[model samples]
Target: MLIALLLAVATVPAGQMFACTPIRVWDGDGPVWCREGPRIRLGGIAAREIDGSCRRGQPCPRASGIAARDALVRLLGGARGRSGTGHILVTGPRLQCRSTGNAKGDRTGAWCSAPRIGDLSCAMIATGTVLRWQRYAAGHCR
Candidate 1:
């Protein structure tokens, strides 16, 4: 299933191409959106609200949302830095992703991530605080 998901990502045509530049991470669950090309969502998982707290029962951090955002930045930063040439082609869901960003109102966008490193939603889930969103997943954990 994972392999199938990975293969779904759309790529550049025969001769044309675009550079995956610095992605400005959004304040919420979104890693903002990629630039110069296709927009993607970090499939499965959704980020905690910027002001959203951790699990209710436990004593969460002062700014858990910020931490998640930072973690995402670090993850993407590492991947971006590793590449010294053209675009990184960070793979992402080619389906359902909004053709353009509309964060504030309708909140329609797709998730994405760096090559071989995996998707941002997965990384955030590995953090233990986040889980796959119910809307896009079959059970809970994919």
Candidate 2:
């Protein structure tokens, strides 16, 4: 349906600027589904996976997956709602992001910023729910 359509057009190339109105979050370093047809993974950071496990070689923060996910939900204008299927419905402001290219699977890794929120990657790190993932930071996680 609509989700399939969004996923199909989700490949935004690296070094491009794009609009994203986040509607759903899937964990901290996300597959944040945007209304304009992109799934973004917040660049420059990493958080625990939903199962509370950190993949080998990834930065492991001292927070649980739920903690990280909730922090991200709050930053994105707070959760409007949530689902049992790990999808968090959010009401965040529209974001402008610069793509760093594909972030595995169907997500684009990007550093996103809104007017009042600033850079999402930095904000997420500030919450201490995630950690700077140097591999993808690319000098942007300040």
Candidate 3:
């Protein structure tokens, strides 16, 4: 029993460790994938006109309907494409972050392909750490 207890204790720390996981972001309206890179654009559109807050749980909004795509592209440095996709596996204390989606009709509720650390998604943004746009896949916007 002593040996078993020791083994259990040894594994407890491992359980606390959080590793980055691969996540996929799909364009809400279609199969298009958001992209990442040095110069990102969404549907060949520049991100200059995009608008919205970067608060955790808040859906990143844009002037055009393509805010989500543009935000992702800018944060991760890539373009929003129909088939372009990338992953930002979070690690360490950042494991608290999570991906989220917007509820229909609410701009702040839009889906986050990759959230910061400790944020979750529901009809509304949760309390705690918030996430900024950061990562993308490849493909054209709908």
Candidate 4:
């Protein structure tokens, strides 16, 4: 069942709406694994890599990678556990997301809104844990 869900969501066309229940969060900017099977990279923002480095030419916030990641976990209802592969499990509300399309690798690029958190990308930036990356952001952060 899960594999079927994954395969179905593997190619979300741009501007499509999808539901997400965040199960694990990898960082402030995301790769937020959803129970519905898509891995979402929060559209319009960038955070430090796990090693505290930003990709070249991207907007880099001053916060460390761990700090940024922890902030996101909290916003997503906090960490409940950790997956064996090191992803931090969370307890966030289901999100309503609009796919911008597939991102680098297998993740989807999307703008997601949580019940209380509103826009995940804007929320992350409001906290200063991440920065808006214009190239991919496409004015979504405004």
Q: What is the C-alpha lDDT of each candidate?
A: 0.45, 0.89, 0.25, 0.87
Worst 10 residues of 2 by lDDT: 1-10
**Candidate 4: Cα lDDT at 140:** 77
Residue lDDT tens for model 3, 13-127: 2112222221222231211221110111111122222233333543343334244433332333344233333322111121121112222222112122335322212201111
Question: Distance from true position, residue 49, model 2, in Å?
Answer: 0.7
Expressed as tens digits, the lDDT of each residue in 21-69 for candidate 2 is 9999999999898888899999989999989999999999999988999
| Best model per lDDT | 2
Candidate 3 has its poorest 10 consecutive residues by lDDT at 34-43
Q: Model 1, 70: alpha-carbon shift in Å?
A: 1.0
Model 2 residue 18 lDDT score? 83
Q: Model 3: residues >4 Å from true position, as ranges? A: 1-24, 27-62, 84-142
Candidate 1 positional error at 28, Å: 5.6
The residue ranges of model 4 lying beyond 4 angstroms of the native Cα positions read 1-6
Itemize residue pairs with steric clashes in candidate 2.
Answer: none
Query: What is the Å distance of residue 98 in model 2 from its true position?
Result: 0.7
Off by over 4 Å in 2: 1-8
Q: Global lDDT for candidate 1?
A: 0.45
Q: Write the per-residue lDDT of candidate 4 for residues 1-142, one digit (tens) a residue.
A: 6347555857466797888899999888889988888889999899999899988988888999888899999899999999999889997899999989988788988999976998888989988889888888887768
